[model samples]
Target: MIRSINVSSATLRHGIIHSPFRLVTKPSNGLRFCRVRPLSRPSRPSIILARLYSDEKSPKENIKPTELAKKVLQEAAKRENIYTIPNMLTFGRLLASPVIGYLVVTHQTSWALAVFGLSCVTDLLDGYIARKYNMQTVVGSVIDPMADKTLMMTLATCLAVSGDIPLYIATLILGRDFLLFLSALYYRYISLPPPKTFTRYWDFSLPSAEVRPTTISKYNTFLQMIYLGSSLVFPVLSQSITIETAQSIGMALKGLEYVVATTTILSGLSYVFSKDAVKILSKPNGKP
Candidate 1:
């Protein structure tokens, strides 16, 4: 005779199927089972579990392009423009150039001199900042000197036109710049190395055999700055000093101009006599 067997509900829920051919009964264990039913519908627990896992997996696939762009922009915004105190000062001088010109033209001598002096301070501070902070950039190298030239040229032109300086002085300074500019152009066109000015300062060492600035060129730039500063200051200072004293100052400024002109000519001659410069100049027209 066959006897009924008992099975736990947990086993049925877990989808463990048993064959109905035999049964063993033990009254001490409290387990029961009804007639086995074939599963007509899919297991609800398994379906729910699959849906939970699929939902968890979708977010990685759903990340859109817009989200990536936002992330990139956020990273970019965190980056900083390099800053140095000296460079900031130099930038201030650049901004002050027009103010100085306006004061000089309006006969505000004291104010113009003050502004010019501030610009000089900025120029000095900028170099210090660059060296101290190690925040130099290619843009700074070009822009710094360009700003200096602008201020110097503007002051020189104003002084020359106003009869404070001789026209020849202005012409000489500007002419040297022009010649150097043309040489730079020639070098660029021939694919030769660029001019070895301050921009190339990093490439050479002390006592190195590189084609570098002649001492005369350095002296020329120094005198140019001196004359520029003096010319800017004289008109303002003249208001306090007697005519003869002012004339003496003017004579001294003119002497500086002559020195600058002579040094400039000598520097240009040195570059012209350089073997590399001669080779570059000898290149055929239309040759790249």
Candidate 2:
């Protein structure tokens, strides 16, 4: 009876342990089982990466127009053709003209005289530099002569107004200028052709055949400078030399004035008679 009881108990325990519900509910034989869906990683932000690359490359790709212009200007400045010593001297003389005029107008006679002397010195230096360095230019040729005439004319007018120089001297100088202007106009218009060849005596050995300063013209320039310098001294020395000395100096300047006037007239006539001058004058307005 006891053995039967024991066997029954054992069978009951085995049935409980091997039940299918228990097996399905719990893991068996130390193995884990899980049903899981595959994970989907977050999508990479490609748009943000593209924008970062574009931002990094933009400055290298974009160049401003002004920067390009500055580069071109720098290249132009590096060229060898433009800067010359003679031209620099001529520019200095030109700049001096206005300063001299201002000094004279302001009644700073000594300063004006000093400035005028500087202008004259620059004139000589320009010519010397041009010859020494072989740095002549067409622009210099025109500008140099024009600057000289302009300075002389300004000084003469100012001195006349200040009563430092006789009115006759100013008149003579202006008259000469006027006559040359008229001749130039006539040569351009009515003459149809101007004379080209200059007399040996009238030629100053300038490279240009059309315009050359004569020996007389050079002397005239020297005398004009002397006259102007003497006027500056006359005012200070008047007490010592008395009226006679002033009058004597005035007479001498007047004589020089006549010589210049005569030479100018004769030279103009000679230019008018030159064959090449005629040829140049004869060209029609557009026939160059």
Candidate 3:
């Protein structure tokens, strides 16, 4: 019956300490009694219980290395690189491109105008923020152009579908872009290590393969945007405007379309003919 009693600290101090809730035969008393005594060092069950309670409150101690790495990466992603202000604007523009295309195809001119206008503003803002904050990243360099091209092509397709612009113009622009994309991919992955055809024709040094937008390409993009925005805006007014006025705007749009098409072709040709492009594709000893 005394075995049910709790162990006292005084009994433990007197060297009677043993595992709690265990029966023991005291040599001095020659009688069975439960020795309820706290161990000087923690018992196995106490150690396990302590770990269980501690793990409940501070679970990081139990996290595996892989999970820790994943968590750290997730936390770090929020603070750097893609999450920056300029990059966020770029991503937002990418998301808005589909909406712009949808609005255009659905003939929601007013809503498309608003969204397209906001995208244009963000386009400017993103560049400015990147420059002012020095927040540029290699990924941004790649995706910024990608976002621009996607938006441009999307709007162009919508315009062509709506009969606002010639389908051939969109075809030409997209064809050039597709060719440039292929060339860039080839230069990046296959040009290095100097292929036999490349080494036989030209002599040049190869650096990192980053396909930057040429000056002509920049102008081409600007003109394309101007053309697209005008195309979107003028049609909204076609409902309230006179035929002569609408025709005048239509003529301007046609002129812009021609200009854009010409620039698109020239920019693509410029890349193909540029010394840098040649150097990137050629070897150091070959001459052309």
Candidate 4:
């Protein structure tokens, strides 16, 4: 191997990185000082720029650009836009859940029906507004379904206590929600980065997992809402109708009860079997 301290003007004009040279602290080309200002990313002619600064260790080796990009994409979790019209509506429904349940339990049939109707309206409007106005958010995704579940559970429990809906159906609904809640807790803990404190676990801003409701689950929610809603309406209508018509409505409701029960079971199983139901956002090792 030949080593030369050639630093000629002509050699520089052509290219200064051709021949073998010893690993000196500085080039012998009289250009002893090198000021490597950080560059965003250089355009084409990548080889020339890299060779000119070969003295500076290759950023590729120390800082893998591919790995950096992948990390960015992985950590690119959506910021929680907790304040939004849709989320506000969802919150409203959540508040109304207890109100509606209390009204039902207290035998305020008319008021309960009114509040439940309002809750359903918000439920429909929130989703539509989120989609049309591009207000879809990560928190919205979470709270929307959460509000629905809360409302459904409250209503189911209330109606069962009032003997409007079957105990078996209520039991099924509560069981499914209980299992899902436990699953959610497990996923959240596993996905949360290290140093997980009580505060961090509850922080929606640092979302650790995503819950994707399955198709059957969605339909089940809709059916359950209808069943619960009809239960509220039944008391008011049964007052205005004849005994024969009341009996017929009761039979219809019984059949609906069977349908809702089947859907609830299927929906619960769907979450268990489906691959995309609940996704863990980060690893236990704190890598996103």
From the highest lDDT down, the ranking of the candidates is 4, 3, 1, 2
- Tens digits of per-residue lDDT, candidate 3, 36-148, equal 44435545444333333343335334545455444445333323345688878888999999999999999999999999999889999988999998997644665677788
Number of clashing residue pairs, candidate 1: 1
Compute each candidate's TM-score over C-alphas: 0.53, 0.53, 0.62, 0.72
- What are the lDDT scores of the predictions, listed in order? 0.59, 0.55, 0.69, 0.78
Of the two candidates 2 and 3, the one with more favorable lDDT, higher being better, is 3
Tens digits of per-residue lDDT for model 4, 65-182: 4544444444444346678898899999999999998999999998998999999999999999999999987667777888999999999999999988889999999999988888
Q: Candidate 4 at 157: error in angstroms? A: 0.9
Q: What are the RMSD figures for all models against the true structure?
A: 20.5, 30.1, 15.4, 11.6
Model 4 off-target regions past 4 Å? Answer: 1-78
Model 3 misplaced stretches (Cα beyond 4 Å): 1-80, 188-208, 276-288
Off by over 4 Å in 1: 1-86, 181-214, 268-288
**Among all candidates shown, the one with the greatest TM-score:** 4
Tens-digit per-residue lDDT, 142-255, candidate 1: 346556766766777777777777898887767766776566454434532334355432331111121244566656666788887777777678988999999898888777
Native-structure RMSD, model 2 = 30.1
